[model samples]
Target: MAALTCRQVGNDFFKEGRWREAIDKYTDAINLDPNDHLSYTNRATTYSKMKNYTAAIRDCKKSIEIEPKHIKAYYRLANSLKMLHCYDESLVTFNTFLGFEPNNNLAQNERTQVKTAIFKEKLQGAQVHPALRILSWANCDNDPLSCKARLLAATLEFNKGNEDGKNRNVKGLIEITEGIMLDERCFIIPSSINLAVNTAFEQNKALSPTLSVRATILKYKQRLAQDGWDSVLPALATNIRAAFLIGYMSRFTPDVRNIDQGIENIRRAIELASFATEIAPVATDDINSIDPILKITFLRTLKVHLMEAILIKYKRNIEMIDLFDKVLQLAKEVIESCNENPISTEDTISYCAYYRGHLEEAYGAIGSAYNERSKFSRGELGFQERDLKLLLESVKNYEKANEYFPSDDPKFALFHYLTASYKLMIGGCTLHEIKQHAQKAKECEKEAYPVFGNYLGDIFEKSMVFQALEQLKRPNNIASDDKYFLPQACHVSSNSEEEEQRFIREYEARTGGTIAATMDLSQAAARANAEFLRNGISIISSDKQ
Candidate 1:
């Protein structure tokens, strides 16, 4: 009776949010009745409220030991484990709790979250092919017809389609397109809505498969706008995934209409993702106020795809300064959030590493965007200062990206080569600076050559040679007495053979015999120069990276 009285006092203190006092009272109760399970469980709850998860876990385990069938003890134990990012243990504990209370919605949601975390962990270092295989396994659920299942299936098909598009496999494209079409059928509302959202869609009644899919998407969007997101929360995952995949897959072909469609779909996905976060109730006081992991995963994926769209638009020479600004803003927001709290727990450590990698990619994209804008600015008069500033900004961002990126990563060489290229393009660069950048570019090409030998390495080497040649050919920049300075440009002429020999000789003399032994710079320089003239600048292709 005395122990019960102490526990009741402790409960009162807990209700008043006097965590330390409540812990003292609970300790009194435990002292009076050493094996009392209720006192232990109550103390565990208090400890958890105090953010003392280790203590909470200990008490929870004790409570369970005293009463094997204690359901609350199991739940508390699982939550404490999850808070510490002991996911495997947390998963086991949740399964035990579910065995006792199988229909608990909160438990089910949490279990699904854990599964998603495990899935993401599995994907950490996987390459594209292995990632596809893992995604394939994820799509093999028993209830494959479920909304979430369909989303996973659609994601797999979209990735396969993307890979196929890269390889220019027409039959594979047709098959994946058909597969995506089948997946779209799952999202069609059973309502009596017509194919037309406006007169434009109505006029084209004999719609192609793509148009039909777009119409279905429009109907779903209309339903979402009419009825609040809550009304379709159950299908939100499928809807968002479908919208994003459809947009991203459109990039496979070079069709302007398809690219436009892709951009619209990606924009919609970003909007929906933002809305989802707004509507979600605040679950914590931490940086991740929503369902942090899941909600962040959605936002991250959508934003990255939006960046991809920006790159696609840039590649096609469409005006996308606005898009570039939007991505820079978005990336800045993510980087700021990721910078906020200090790492404390295992969960925080993992989140930091995961987000750091994305941040590296984000910086890389920003660097490339700035570089492209610099090139674009060169075409207009009186923007030389702006162009130089943009180039400097590009250099700054690329250096930041290198700082965040792992030195041993295969992509590091690519970024290094990029940095080297832009560094040389900086207006009024000193001769010493030129040599430094040129040497760095050569080193990066050497490192990447073995790995990307067939096509990518050749491209980098040729581009570097062309940039170096252009710099050397600038008559007023360097003294004529300097060995690296050339009196005239190495222009290709009708006498191809003689010009080629002269170009190779000039390149060797300028570099002081440091040129690659296997390099045939004549054809390489011509091709690079032609591509440079056509594209204005060689923007980094996000998809290839």
Candidate 2:
């Protein structure tokens, strides 16, 4: 009775926007009736309105304790958890509320928003396709944060996939950024970031838009000059520069001059970030909901870029060992910092693992290339033995990389393809063993084609197609000679076949809605035959003419 009176007064105070008065009334009610769940929930709502998420969460938990199935308390708790960046916990609470009130549109919408938030967080750490699909889902409320997140996500995806198809739409990111820039709260964020992303795609260098390649760096610099640098801006600049290096260096041939310029910019960005940290005690505190650990993440990513750039310059050089060791030590230190205060997402962990894996792969590849060159340049002995050892090492490192990424990630396709290539080059392996690995690599590459839209997978698949064709036309090489023998004793053929079929089935099931038909052996065989016949007919027609 007294509790009811206090709640009524609290509601009046809340309606009048007197948050503290409402909190006082609710507190009085809770003291009078310690088990009054309504009082606790009302107080929680007041706390939430004040943006005191921690206090709100406590009150909501108390309300839920009094009544386990309290729907409002569950909702409030979920919102508070979300505000605190406890996404997984908030998701569970949202699910609980939805389970009880199945038809609540508001709850359903909130659940979708929470799911979007989770996807956004996951995307930041790693490239997850399902997360991208959810980010692109229709019916999402016009949430500013979600909009910004989706823009960034789409930008990444477009950068990865745009090369595969010219019709791919990435303009949405720029358009959304343009809209968001109109809001005073959002005006501080650099709009050129997305615009540059869009322009980079236009220049067919989306993978790595160097400052010189695309005017993105110029725009970013201009924006910084106009807006002035904040504690977060330096870190963001470092990230932008690192991204450029990764994309640019991944090319078949990178320009050393451009790399040097990008490296200088990254170093300057790092110095700026250090200065920001020195000036601000709360340098790593969350700014506008962006993670404070970005400075370290950017620094770590920059180190990786530097390693890659240096590797490119010295990959085939005998003196590369000293530089590689220094970079590896620095990367280890950056990774140690992450462990102590972990700012980056699982994606960053995977990114670090990928870089380490690449380092190992680079060492093995460079060593093999150097040994091969030594035969001509330095007259080194046992080049063949060193080749096999180096190839094996490369395969093992790539496999380790695969383990770090998700099972179906397109990135693993490169690892598998490289492994297969090395296995074939290793020699002494049976025809069946070599063929099985080659086929596995081809299939993995083929499956990844849609995501990255790159020709590397096509290159791998073509290698298998050529092998398969050679087996039919000329029974000379391992692939051709091995066609007659299905060495069951080896188990590689049977195991790889089963794995391949399982991968195809899983891919089909997951992409049933999006993909009309998946490529298979039958299609590949038919295509190969058609090409052979066309070539034979061309020869016959030329002779007749």
Candidate 3:
């Protein structure tokens, strides 16, 4: 077939590092057989490699139009779009990737990265005043310190997760400035200082945006090396640079540049999540969420692009495994897409943790969900309640997933299965046998399974699928925090009359048992006492005779 010849030429070109030639051959293949999904997909991938975003998107899209399930095409399109800084479109693409392989960590991380980019854009027009920091400070209208304070506040708020609102709160923008300024060499927080200074200067509104960012980044780079940790510091600096770029460029680029920064920031946030996952628990209260909660440019297409980068790109660069781990964390954070109600956030977090190799955390999280399963009102169960069956299916998925899941592999399948087992136990499933089964799951997983492959990417790299076969047994001793990552209010839109009724039913169940027992205690006691006295007298008479 002429099409086959063209495809072979294209693939040969791709292998020989002639990306331009590969793109041409892929195009020729498509021309020969317009219906061939591979031709368009191959060409699209080549276009992405070449950074020819428009052509990449076009070819990938054509492949998808012809075959809706052309996941590779979707991935290529998303990547091309990300390169072009079209985040929303990319998000849609990544979403499609997730639909096909919900377990893919790359897609999830890309989604988070994109989301952060989107977030940065909305943050551009942040109001500023002494009290508001990120936004304008309203109440400090009469104060002499109002002008400088507001500007300081804005930078402070930007450092926090407020996409728009500034340091209006007492922890006002100025305090962060104070925190950084008090210790010029605050090796404990280079990102924070860099973030604050960058924010303050960019929000000056009086200076050239480009010049301001360039200067701030220059300063940021000089001091960035002070922060510790060998592998993670560079990624952190990249993130801080992204933040500075976002704020400084806001004036000149408006939405466009902000989107790019946001995309970058989300990537950073994922990095931060990865950092936090491995770090020791510091006793100090850090009430803050990771900074720069960027909006993911999550289109189903972009997810595919990110996913491919992890599987294909990282396969060649094994050192990027840590980054991929973060990507997995970011993905698990966003892509659950489960509706509210009985669908447990615990389960969601646990699943993500499972994929990331935090097995104990995963089990603890899932166990929390299972025990709390009976707590939600029937009316409050939302469509996510349907996940109950899916949850059971997930148990099987984890069982099988762990069968090949790595003990040290970030895919944390053993934890997910154990969590599922705990949930099953609470739900009146065979508790004792489930324990043995759970133990076996851990033992088999630890003893078996290979750790040779990169992270899981189901679409293009199907050959590397099911790499890990088993992991060793471990106890789930980590105390359950039972805290919700996503707010509980998200579960129920608003408690309805139906929910009200269910609430009453639950309330009655708790109180009714005690009330009944109390009522029966007096009467039952009198009868027992009478019988005891009668038997004692009769026994005494017999002894006397």
Best by TM-score: 1
- Tens digits of per-residue lDDT, candidate 2, 1-545, equal 98889989999999999999999999999999999999999999999888666678889888999999789999999887776556678888889998999898987898888899877766664343322323222222223222223333333333323332233334433332222212111212233444444553544322233344235445544555666556235434334433443333333345656655555554544544454344333543443243332445435544544555555555545455675555446545544654554432334332222233333333433333333332222235312223446456555656555554333344455556655545544433333454555556557655444333343635743454334323332112224322322121122333455654554455456556233144443333333333433343221111110
Every candidate's lDDT = 0.56, 0.50, 0.40
> Of the candidates shown, which would achieve the greatest lDDT relative to the real structure?
1
Quality of model 2 by C-alpha lDDT: 0.50
Report per-prediction Cα RMSD to one decimal: 16.4, 15.4, 25.9
In angstroms, give how far residue 105 of model 1 lies from its true place: 47
Query: What ordering of candidates by lDDT runs from best to worst?
Result: 1, 2, 3
Off by over 4 Å in 3: 125-545
Of the candidates numbered 1 and 2, which has the greater TM-score value? Answer: 1
Per-candidate count of clashing residue pairs (backbone under 3 Å) = 0, 2, 63
Shift in Å, residue 363, candidate 1:
1.8
TM-score of 1: 0.43
lDDT pick, better of 1 and 2: 1
